[model samples]
Target: MPTILHRRWLVGGAALLILLALTAGYIFLTTAATAPARARIQAAASMRPFGEVDQEVVNARTLVEDTPESARAWSVLGLAYLQLARETADPTNYGRADEAFQRALDLDAASVDALIGAGTLALARHEFAEALELGTRAMELNPTIPRVYGVIADAQVELGRYEEAVASVQTMVDLRPDLASYSRVAYLREIHGDNQGAIDALELAVSAGGPAAENTEYVRVQLGHLYFATGDLARAEQIYGESLARLPEYIPALDGLARVRAARGEYSEAIELYEQASARIPLPGTIIALGETYEAAGDQGRATDEYQLVEAIQLLFEANGVRSDVELAAFSAAHGDDADRALALARDAHVRLPTIFAADVLAWSLYRTGAIAEAAGVADEALRLGTQNSVMLYHGGVIAAADGDTDTARTRLEAALDLNPRFSPLLADRAAAALAALDN
Candidate 1:
């Protein structure tokens, strides 16, 4: 039996010891739980530039799957899957990424990383509404998350909500100030008739070192396009050359260089560059550019050949379940000397797409074959789509002028110039001539 004072001392000492043990144990558990999350964050940050890290990501995914209790682990797994999808462009990878993100959401419904990754995948698939919803949710969950705004910007761009895209990208730049956000914003500026603004934004993008080589190359190519659009062909040529120096196989740079050369009346040089680009990508845009270059060079035979190749590719694409009616109509109308074939292709495309661009092509094909009335009808239908596209407006104006509707022709031609003041010199010259003819 201890004395009263001695027993009080003994009890106080035991309680102090218990408190110290509990504090030490809590610190140890917290650190143990957080170590893996910190490591995963470090790994993800390191793997951003190396797009070909699919195998490493798969291993990370396995680790996360094994750790069912860790929300951060699921985020790591989702990010890995997203990276794999970006590298492979396999939609299945996106599906897997979505599943991983969904698991993360289940674990922690407010996970910002999961929302951003899921939104990004939706954007890549052109599911704009889903992307917007997910991106908005991500921002709501964590307003500080820069990638959430990036997802929103991409979805806005795909939906042709350029103004909203610009605002979202601006917010992303404000937060993280990364090259991707700047590049996208610059492109939107260019589309909105702010050529200098685009150049400034792209300069910032080039200065920002976070963009990978491929992304930097793309930015340079876009810079060249902006310069070309602003009639600074020399600067455009220099930028394209720089891009090519950085990535010799960059097809967009080659195409940009070809356009600049063609503008400078170096048709043969332009034709060579266009040919190289076409050989590399074989895309409809590249093919069309090559044909146009050849046509500028007065080499109708080569131009016809390029257009025929485009038609062949379009047919192959269609056979492979890829609808390319708009491209097919464009190539056929411009290069198919057989009016009947051009009209047939254009009609089929109009029936399929029914958009302003498709309708414009159908109208142009009809006009080429001297069917003014039908062309006018189709062009009018195109105008109802409410897209103030310069090219479409120009086509409609031409059709109306051909049909002796001087008032409508003047209105549309003026609208085209208002929409795109630098709308191709050829089209502008035609518009001017039509207006002069009306006056006379």
Candidate 2:
């Protein structure tokens, strides 16, 4: 492995090259009409922060207030809002981002910055098609910009266009192999069942680093998740712990440590960690994790309360025009909340996105509602990408068993266990029991 100093030197050189390339792209793409606003916004992007990007939001908002007619100013505000949303796990920022981006587009429909910002917001809201469209438009306007390809690749991946996503990610990394592009590479590698390759790419991303501590820690948490997913609990815990040590109570690191604790059967510790995360930000995923930890610890009442909080957050998300159907469908099906509603949400999500994850949730919901054959078919769709996600495998295994495909059930269940025996505190044991029953 290269030393951290060596990696930093390489990244610094590459960043210099990227800066020159981006400068050229900006010159070529910027018109006299938008040049001033665009230059100011791009300059603001270079302001390094200690641990948060909220300062960017403040700066952009001030700029927009001063120059209300500047489309680029509004676009940067939208982008900043999106960044704040990611850091805080506050879905309400989605609404602010949408409004700001829309205003930018209303002022200048051809603004590439606004288009990319809207695309990112759409991606966050699970509107894969819209994200793809906006990203494509941005690329057409300014193909030299590397980050546009990140948006395109992300949307392509979610839309199940794996080959296109791969090509886009390749182009991105070739243009600028920084944290953003390298992370995309890692994701594509992971979905192709190449865990080690993914880890290698993510390590490179970490070395490339980011302008904000949150950015680096966010990638670190993802690295930890990959380790945890592959059953390297100790490494995952170490990574999460180190991240939390560097940035006290970072929500993603806290959640990761909680997961590691739960996997190790330290339910009390897991519960405490998750509660801390939830208190910091009532993100649906954190709430769901807290609920599941409670369920694992035999605290049904608290678990139910946490689950209800998730429902309330979902409602808030919907009111903000952010879609949560796929997530809600999977959660409802898993918890036996509302079979009909879950199935409906799953179908709607699949119709809108048709992603592998949506397919998995649809399959799970169908199975929960007793549509065994249909569920099996959808489960196959979910596995079509050969992604090595253990939860999807577990769902596939159970659905196959229900559909009377004993061989497939055994194979998928075995694969899930082999990949990660402790994939989920709530479901891993159930998967093992099902596999044992099949053997019997």
Candidate 3:
């Protein structure tokens, strides 16, 4: 087998004159009144450049300073910190966010905004059960709040509670058919193999988002991803280019474009983009992608360094109480010396919550450890939603082939190659070889 590298706004207005300025101020005040402080925070946090994120953090801090007893101000500060953390990939910001959320709760224990913020932070930390509990409580506090449903839906999705997630997201879209709601719908549809439906939802998401906001660019990238999954590389490339035009530093867009380049066998161009993407967001996945590119180019030393970087980052995350279970398990299954340890870690991760991603790792690990029957079961879970991921299908196909499921293996491997012929330099070559063997 060959290598595997598949990865995955606010407006401000100025007043014309003093009266115009006052009128704008009055408008903001009235809007804030109806929108709630958290909504306003979310809007500001989602839109514009990092300048706006910084400004919001400052503004929230000032508000809390002026009114220490105001739970809303504290919650707003917490959310701004969280947003900053997301943009910068700085885990320290999460600590600051934690304090801000707790402070908000201290001021007002039943504050739904604070609860939701905390829940979201938990989700980021991969504490799915905790996130769900916090989300559930926040929902009980206010059922009509759209964002609360989103938090709960996200938690459910991570926990493999797809039916519940679908129901929750339906309510979310019904209440507010905006970017957040439409994006969630897009992903659910994609997972369910409804490619057309996914594309339709993402288009709505793009339309619902304002140009000034980064969310608009984000949705554009999602639309590109749907196109990519359908093997429409030209459309995917076009959409990704559009997204980068608006949000030049968006890591996901950079990574998506990098993958597109790699799939076309543009190794040098792919390497350049992957480097830029990894520098901005050195997550395990991005690093892994970079490693695959290096390996494809026969730069074994650099590839080894990238793998070490992933391990170091995983350790750092674990130390910070952030569970990197899926990444850790996947990495171990692929690279760990001890097959038993790899299988155990994967199994443990799956037991916590069988996310489709976790299930894929578990299947790979089980196969590695020669637990063929269990691997088959785990593979079923991985493909349950019909996710069109080349690496996942490749792994599943190889596993099934080892277990004497030639028919299933051929179907999956063929689908992977059809989806993206150059999905992984190693895996693609491997898939072709496997299919040839099965035919013989």
Best-performing candidate as measured by lDDT: 2
Best by TM-score: 3
**Residue-level lDDT for 204 in candidate 1:** 71
Give a tens-digit lDDT track for model 3, residues 234-334. Answer: 88889889888887767778978987887787889989999887665555667788888888888989988877766655554554455767768888888
* lDDT tens digits by residue: candidate 2, 79-123: 888777766554457678889999999999999999988987777
- Model 1 spans with C-alpha error above 4 angstroms: 1-125, 133-137, 315-393, 396-440
- What are the models' TM-scores? 0.61, 0.85, 0.86
In candidate 2, position 119 carries an lDDT of 87
lDDT (Cα, tens digit) per residue for candidate 1, span 6-59: 212111000000000000001111134344323332343343444345666867
Off by over 4 Å in 2: 1-52, 65-69
On TM-score, the stronger of 1 and 2 is: 2
State the local distance difference test value for candidate 3.
Answer: 0.74
- Clashes (backbone N, CA, C under 3 Å), per candidate, total 0, 0, 6
Q: Distance (Å) between predicted and true CA of 87, model 2?
A: 1.7
TM-score between candidate 2 and the true structure: 0.85
Ranking by lDDT: 2, 3, 1
